[model samples]
Target: MRHKCRIAQLGLPADQRKALLRNLTTELIRHGQITISQARAKALRKEVERIITLAKDGSLASRRQALGYVYDKKLVHVLFAQAPERYGNRNGGYTRIIRTVNRRGDNAKMAVIELV
Candidate 1:
């Protein structure tokens, strides 16, 4: 029984699942938004939030910790050096997920994950 589990697997194995979540989080941070399948967005949301929370800390260790999850070095640099300033005054709830029409290929639900 998958009782109270937090992750959204999106049918991927463990390593792939981790990579998907990490890449999506990096993209979302760089773009301030991203469009993807619903399950992916749901899975990536917590990770995105966690990184932003880390950004809020504004410590060197926190920046390095965040870099561990975000793959793009440029994007990671921007997040640590700039994003925190953009979102400095706010608390949490940095990301927003909006459901969109289902994808035509396989009828998978789609959603746009963005920052507010």
Candidate 2:
């Protein structure tokens, strides 16, 4: 039984999956939005939100944690600097995902994931 298995494997091995999510999260933080496959967007949403939440903490430990996950050190510094002001009043729901048309070649459902 696949009960309570909420995490999506996304057809990738564990290492690849983590790498994909980490890269997606970094780009989302850098660009504010990105268009990607729906399944990937869904999985990426969780990671992005978690990192933003850590940024909200604005603590040395939280910053270190985020730095560990994010690929770019400079980007992490920028994010930590801006996140408090940007997300200070808000709580959670830092990202929004909007469904878009399917890809032409693969017909995969696509969506735009953006920071809110």
Candidate 3:
């Protein structure tokens, strides 16, 4: 019954899913890349792109919005400071997801999600 539903549940409750994405987004912004489950990478892509778009905006409201979602204030500041020059020419698609080998234990598909 997916119908018009688009959000991936990731088999987690709302709060946990938000927290997981928040952590992943924070680490991705901090390190510029991260390895994660394919499903999570897919989900994280949307959030990262949205946040970077906000950073690109570089408005006080947008910065506040990004700060609310991103856990690290310093990282948000850096991202906002750099986003315009780094991504000015680009419209969207701020991240790339490269499929990697399956996990050793459960065979879950893994992927490296990195900033473009």
Global lDDT scores for all candidate models: 0.84, 0.95, 0.97
lDDT by residue for model 1 (1-116), tens: 88998667789999988987887887787778888988888778888888988888879898899878888877777777776688888888888899999999999999999988
Checking candidate 2 for backbone clashes, the offending pairs are none
Tens-digit per-residue lDDT, 19-52, candidate 2: 9999999999999999999999999999999999
Candidate 2: lDDT over CA atoms? Answer: 0.95
Higher-scoring candidate on lDDT, 1 or 2: 2
Which ten-residue region of model 3 has the weakest summed lDDT? 1-10
The RMSD (Cα, Å) of candidate 1 is: 1.5
- Better model by lDDT, 1 or 3? 3
TM-score of 3: 0.97
List the candidate 3 regions with Cα displacement exceeding 4 Å: none
For each of the candidates, give the backbone clash count: 0, 0, 0
Per TM-score, what order, best first?
3, 2, 1
